[model samples]
Target: MRIIKAAVLVAAGAMLSWTPARADTVPEFRGNDTGGIIAYELAHRVDARQLAVDHCASYGKVAKFLAVDAQYGGYVSFACRWVPYGASNQPLRTLY
Candidate 1:
């Protein structure tokens, strides 16, 4: 039983390593709210993790209504949550 478990674990690790890397973003980034934002940011960082903003802008670059919110590691700071577009505000949407 122990040997079987070890073999299974080894197989799982091997499969994970075999997972192909895409030209786009990481698992955290995608199409909607958290998903889309994570996807775009991951793609941006795929080359070099360094970002221009202290935190991610709201709605990333796609949404013009809400503020921006950046992510570093797992933590998110509020400071620049307001849109840089200035005034003309609306509902916030975080996405690509």
Candidate 2:
């Protein structure tokens, strides 16, 4: 009975120490200027969008989402379009 208890304790400790591998949550960008593709999980779409916006902003442009592909995971394709001057520069109002 004592040996069985020891085995159970060891198994519990081992189980507690084990950790599952984590998925890559960081967004990855590819391409330049005119357009680009972003690779990321659906769970992290907001981060991916922000990345795209930042990338386009460097080119003095805005990110225009083109498509979302779920094949082989997820991807967001976007274009860097120029934002016209005198356009509404107000902070985005969210209904949330």
Candidate 3:
């Protein structure tokens, strides 16, 4: 009887300890046209954006905001453009 009880307790403890892997959403940045990416695990959207923009700027270019949208888990998706050839404020979208 004691062996059975010990086995049951061990099984229950194992079951409780074994947790399924979770796919949690995190903050990420990507260029809309250039395909540059910056990823960060930040809790706030504003902070994530700032970190991404700062990372993108470290590549020696300017980061421009194209668009922003809501992502999963309250994260914001930022569409940006890195001005090339030292030309600042270049429009990514062209007019016909």
RMSD of each: 10.1, 9.0, 9.4
Give the per-residue lDDT digits (tens) of candidate 3, residues 1-96. 999999999999899779765657433545443434444333242455455466455554445444343443333344444466766554332222
Among these predicted structures, which one has the highest lDDT?
A: 2
Sort every candidate by lDDT, greatest first.
Answer: 2, 3, 1
- On residues 1-96, what C-alpha lDDT tens digit does candidate 1 reach at each position? 999999999999999889977755435532333322333355355521222132234444323222334445431212223345765755444333
TM-scores, one per candidate: 0.27, 0.53, 0.37
Report the error of model 1 at residue 55, Å.
24
Best by TM-score: 2
TM-score of 2: 0.53
Show how many residue pairs clash in every candidate, following the order shown: 16, 0, 0
Candidate 2 stretches greater than 4 Å from native: 1-27, 42-46, 88-96
Q: List the residue pairs that clash in candidate 3.
A: none
How many angstroms is residue 5 displaced in model 1 relative to the true structure, after the best TM-score fit?
0.1
